[model samples]
Target: MDMAQRETWTSRVGFIFAAVGSAVGLGNIWSFPFQTASNGGAAFLVVYLLAVFLIGFPTMLIEFVIGRRSKQNAVSAFSELGYGNWTFAGVIGVFASFITLSFYSVVGGWVLNYIVGSVTGGYLGDASTFFGSVSSGTVAVAAHAVFMAITIAIVAGGVADGIERATKFMIPAILVLLAGLAVWGSTLSGASAGYAYYLSPDFGVIATNFTSIVPSAMGQAFFTLSLGFGVMVAYASYLGRDDSLPGDSAIIVVLNTIVALLAGFAVFPILAATDALTGSTGAGTAFVALAGAFGQLPAGRIIGFVFFVVLLFAALSSSISLLEAPASYVVDSYDTERWKVAVGVGVVAFLLGIVPAYGYVGLFNDFVFNILLPIAVLFIALFAGWIYGGEAVDELGRGTSLGRGAMTAWLWWVRVVVPIVVAYTLWLGVTNFYAGLVNGAYF
Candidate 1:
């Protein structure tokens, strides 16, 4: 009986593209390639695919359920659903949003710098040396400030005109440029070698790598799609109950998966063809390998322009969503003004972003994808499974026959299976993260 749902998108396509835009950023482009390489490419892909179906879909439905049910942002949604302790989960969404956006904006800054550099032909030389020259101190800080400003400006402008309009441009550009790059990459001299490295299977590696791979793959699936920590909940707060939650979530999940798969096609071939596949193996893998590939292109400058432009846009699209998670709570629950919410969140998040804006970018990035995301997702699953309880199934399954049947089994799996697995992975990630500090490990 809440009367607070915001007006949603005008069309299905617009909504779908927005979700895809959120899901398809560096997680797919930068993170996925390196992850695929480190974990046996095709074998890890198999495990990843399985994890997406088993854990990702159900969990997504869970968040959407919470969002739609309460018809409010994360905090209000939780409190509105019933009362008491659950409201704290909504606040957690705000905290997670801040932590996630801090590092994300830094990486986004790198994407912007690359686009500018690409257009300027800065990557036309030896990659290893050029990459060493591009990171940190001045360049990173400058780009970081520029990207953060863009995020803040957009948030300050309000959601529909700012977020929606920007995403419409960025999402299509990302897809078109990526597809073009993949096609061009396939035509390169050694493209097959890269394709083989990417697509070839190695069962033995998967067997030995499975323990570590579980946490990594699980983290990727959740973070790439912006699941777990009430992002979907916040987004769904814009919807009406007449629209089916489960049906909507299905479309969202499918489109997001397509974007992720498309990214692999766009990036891996270029790396293999340029003999830069090995470059993605280390600390500067993204800068070294990707810049090297762009440098080798016939008109690497133009390609770099398009590639990083799309990456910058992708990061912005996702960052807006991250910011909205908290802003929505403030604006919706407390009746805060949109302008105040925007500036307050932006100023606060910008200050916190400084921590990861410098030398700790990669480590913080790993901690986000590897640790924070999984923990948030586990809570979301439990909320859908136990907190929302049978109401989750009813809420999700209200419109379509497929949705009704789909919700039943997914609920059980989330309730019983996913939490145990996620909790175990969280333990491993935390322990390994601590061990790295104790042993001076940097991977």
Candidate 2:
């Protein structure tokens, strides 16, 4: 298939929803709250907002320009841009997407189990024990297969009818449901405490843990925005030239942040009301802590059902994007049929997912979240800021309202500032991983 023959987003609304769907995923629902809870609450939110605007926006624009300009998959985008070695950046992105989907589907399966349990009153027990039972063995694998099957069905529809149509409904439904949850959460008896814990800034904590908090904030910003994985690049390949890259990027960031913040509001109040906060983070926070909270609520069954349904939507919206990146690559690079490529990618990702589904979620997450993701973003910043340089500015300016001075400033930030910060964060991830290995006696 020729590049020109590729499908474009049906409209700007479709593009925005598709892009936001990619950005707003499990990270927003599962990871963001725990991250905020562990890393200074509102203090972390402050730093995270800074990271989103300063680091996230610039790097996002870089991906948008590259994808829109090349109208190719991530790998071929770099390759077509005359950066042969830089093609590794796209390769890193595709691999990262695969690694991410591997463990991501595992977590998705966990969420799926919770959804079933919530509806069937099966979650009326010890939350920790329940999570443990569902997280591994045959049940986990079965749930993972079901989740991947739904994701593949959407991806196989190709760009317009599949991704765009699905996200159009999914994103709006997610927002509406989340808003309802937030309202209900605020009405809980302990809502005040939850709000205070989530919104009350502690400068003392930020000052004392500057090094730790900043890196966490930066990583969360990158993760929630789905950067460094060629997702934005793949989504943007279907973008029309008339769309404003900067404007669309800003809208995606804002919508994603809203969803993340609302998740905190919806979850924290319920946790506080039920005394189930427990200082937990990560998968345990969502599955165990929140599950326990739901079990203790007045109309516990109904709330649990709705909450898990929201999670399912968030997970599916994001998972499809993850699958789309590599599937897009296979179709564009191999000149293969889209449906065939989608199915092939789905099967391979499913097989790989079994590794993490069985119990390696931590290891898979460590590789993708802590390492590959940051490094991929760093490479993108280097390419945009250094290699692509002025041409990138022209691309950003193309079909948009950016004036000469504005474009120049955007270019400078992408080339100079964003790279320096991302490189520093990348170094932090590398050293942290090394230290973990050494401490564990694996090195």
Candidate 3:
């Protein structure tokens, strides 16, 4: 099929849901609150919002332009937009997506396990033991296969029938579920403390932790938006050029932020009310601490069921995007059928995921999130700001209402500010990884 004959999003709303589906994933729910909590709570949220609007928003628009203008997948989009070797950025993006899904599906599998366990009372005992049991061996592999199959099924359905349709329902379902959870959680006795902890700014802490916290906030901003890995480019590739890149970006950003904040509100209150370890973060926070909270909360079983269902949907929403990045690239760059591309890439990603699922989870997480992703993002920024340059701005401004001043500001942010901040974050991640390696501290 000719690139020009490719399927497009049926409507602007579908496109927005698809994009929001990509951005609102495990990171938004499981990761964002932890990052905020560890980095000075409300203070970190302020910085993260700044990074989102100033850095993430413009960069996202650039990706949208790259995809819609080219009407191609990530690798092909770059080749269509720029000169030779620019496609290498797309290659990196594709590779990063594969690595991301490998571990991502492992976590997705865990979510599936928890969903089943919540109903059957399987995780009602020691959270650590349950997590340990679920994270490896035959159980992990089986769960991962199930998760990947679901992701592949969606990707195989093509654009309108699959990605967009699924997200249109799933995103709204998540909002409703989280909203209900938040409202219920607010009635808990200690909910006020949770809100205070999440929203109160400690200026002294922010000042003292400024240097360390900025990287976290920036990383969260980038990751929460699902940038740096060609996911957005692939999603945007299906968009009609008439779509407003800036407006769509705003909608996606707002949806992602709200979901993240809602997750924090819902989880933190339950944690506070139950006296689950408020200091914890990451997988443990989501799995263990949150599971413990569910056991103690009123209607605990029902709450656990709803929370894990939301978690599974959130993970699946993002996993499909991760799978799509490489699948779309293969279909576009190799002229393969979408189903074959999806199955082949998905099986390979599943096999690769087993290694992380068995063990080395932390190592894989660090290498991908802290290193490969940031590097991919940096290249994207440089490619758009320097290589694509004026053409990129023209694409962004096309069929949109962005004035010259807005375009100029967006250009400057993408070209100058994004690269510099991303570079610093990448550097910090590299240094930290190395330091952990030397001290035998990294997993």
For candidate 3, the lDDT comes to: 0.84
Task: Please give the RMSD to the true structure for each candidate, in Å.
Answer: 2.3, 1.7, 1.5
lDDT for every model?
Answer: 0.74, 0.86, 0.84
Clash tally, candidates in order: 1, 1, 0
Give the candidate number with the greatest lDDT. 2
Which model is ahead, 2 or 3, in terms of lDDT?
Answer: 2
lDDT of 2 by residue, 1-443 (tens): 58768889999899899989988998898888888888878888898989999999888998999999889889899887888789999999989988888778888999899989998777677888888889998999999999999999999998889999999998998899999999999899988998998898988988998777776788888878989889999889888888899899989999999999999989889878987653735555677888888888888889888888888889989899999999998888888998899889988999999988877786677567668888899888888888888889888997778799998888888778887887787777777666767786221
Model 3 off-target regions past 4 Å?
A: none
| Model 1 steric clash total | 1
Task: Write model 3 residue lDDT over 1-443, tens digit each, in one string.
Answer: 58666888899999899889889998888778777766777888888888888788888887887888888878888667656588888788888888989988988998999988898887877777888889888899999999999999999998899898999999999999999999999999999988998888787887898766776777777777888788899888887777788889999999898998899899778877877525735545578777777777678878899999998889988998999999888888778889899999999999999898887566776677668777888888898888888888888887788798888777777889888988988888887778768987645
Stretches of candidate 2 off by over 4 Å are: 438-443
The predicted structure with the larger lDDT, 1 or 2, is 2
Stronger candidate by TM-score (1 vs 3): 3
- The predicted structure with the larger TM-score, 1 or 2, is 2
Q: Estimate each model's TM-score.
A: 0.93, 0.97, 0.96
